[model samples]
Target: MKKQRPPGLIAIVAYKAFVASLLTVTSIALLFALKNHKILENFSESYLLETKLKIIELLLDKFLIVKPKTLLFSGLAAGFYAGLTAVEALGLWYQKGWATILVLVLVGISIPPEIYELFQGLTLLKLAVFIANLAVLWYLLHHLPKHGKAD
Candidate 1:
């Protein structure tokens, strides 16, 4: 019989679930974007609310025009990653060694990109995310059982 995991450990699993949910939503939104490319254009034309057109146009400029194939491929990739994260969450909840390995690898790989982003510009949000990731990586690496169920 296995013992219960600590609150911190469980929190990480919960975080993973939250991330998986977010990615799933993003995937759907991207797929929908393909069909609803000019939703704002259509709405403004019909609703006659074009006073703040400059702001709307500026916001639209930042968004990329995604093709159906691009959205589908991106959605599939996001879904695959979300699935991996969900599985990792489950395994971690059960105190599996392989889960730790997977998390360590994923988080470790993510650190470099995060740091690069920070160098591009420092923001409270980016700093917080980097700190959180670092803390999670540290916690899992140090606390995981030396010999536990894995593979």
Candidate 2:
């Protein structure tokens, strides 16, 4: 008989999958923007005029200043991250030990940078992400010993 996965494990897998999807979309959008920079700028200008939201305006300003090479690099990086996240999700779904370690190490590595960013600017989004990663790390650490022989 096969062992059933715990709900927390399922939640972790789902969260990773969701993050992968978001990253995939972001990668695609950035790539598309790179290809159609002029069109995007025009569209954004019109959209900005219609909305006039300060946050959107600020984001658009930043977007407008980004060079094509930067866009390409960002797009590639996001795509690579998306791929990594998808792998993590798949490995966890199959209850692979390496996947757990991969997630732990990756999440662990990100913590210092996240804290630094928070110190730089304490935004709600940053706080939420930090909290989420911490929760995932805590859950994995607490549950790992019980699972045993991950390999």
Candidate 3:
């Protein structure tokens, strides 16, 4: 059996999961708020409401207009992230190998979009997040103990 490493990697995974969970909760809250608005009570009553109603009228219309598929995919991805994070945090909290590798993979996949956004119009918040993400990625990849597993 391989000796386990310290808890640093899982700690980072937990932090990332915490952020994703916050986003999930925020999105659900926004959906609920939109659904409960009185302006949406009778979706066919006014022109604006009718437009909204038409947008939601059919599966294809809703799929294309509201991009529910994208939302669904995002929700699923968030859930997956949370699940992976929890597994790493709780099960192998002190096991550096798997958790560290997973974090690196996640960061690798996420950085491209941040870079693309940076080229369009740089905002402080976006730049801050991108930098923070890069920092976290660097910290995890660099601090993880060298073992056969990492190769």
Candidate 4:
């Protein structure tokens, strides 16, 4: 059997998806680290009482109140999601097994909650990001090799 090249569209979409996932993972990790380090624990509110700084200080206070275990688990889940996305992208790019199909199913399951968020109030940025993700997932799933191993 001859190895086939993945479709150009699939390559582009998968690479974009890979980058998105990487960014998501990195952002989540950074948030976790910042919360864990308690670097904001001792900022003198009286000295740095500017409105913007106050708002951030208040937000960090709320964030720091969340349970550490919960934060850790959420961070781990985000990492797993990103790792799986990377795998999906690799599979799509290589025209390997059914990774694209798996990713589509995962995305399909995920969209309902996001759609509800959209219905509540959809920002242009949120809509664009969701649409781009859907488009990439669809393109890769659609262009997957017609014949391949069951795995």
Estimate TM-scores for all models.
0.80, 0.84, 0.58, 0.69
Worst 10 residues of 4 by lDDT: 37-46
Tens digit of per-residue lDDT, candidate 1, span 77-112: 888888998998898887888888889899999999
- The whole-model lDDT of each prediction reads 0.79, 0.89, 0.62, 0.66
Residue-level lDDT tens digits of model 2 in 73-93: 999999999999999999888
Check candidate 1 and list the clashing pairs.
Answer: none
Clashes of 1: 0
Q: Which predicted model would earn the best lDDT?
A: 2
Q: lDDT of candidate 4 vs native? A: 0.66
The number of clashing residue pairs in each candidate reads: 0, 0, 0, 0
The local lDDT score (0 to 100) that residue 56 gets in candidate 2 is 71
- Expressed as tens digits, the lDDT of each residue in 1-151 for candidate 3 is 9676546544565666677677667557445534444434344345564456554555333433444455556656655665665654543355547766766787788899999999999999899879878887887667756522542
What RMSD, rounded to one decimal, does every model reach? Answer: 2.8, 3.1, 7.3, 3.8
Q: Model 4 off-target regions past 4 Å?
A: 1-8, 11-37, 44-52, 144-151
The TM-score, computed over Cα atoms with residue i paired to residue i, of candidate 1 is 0.80
Error of 3 at 124 (Å): 2.2
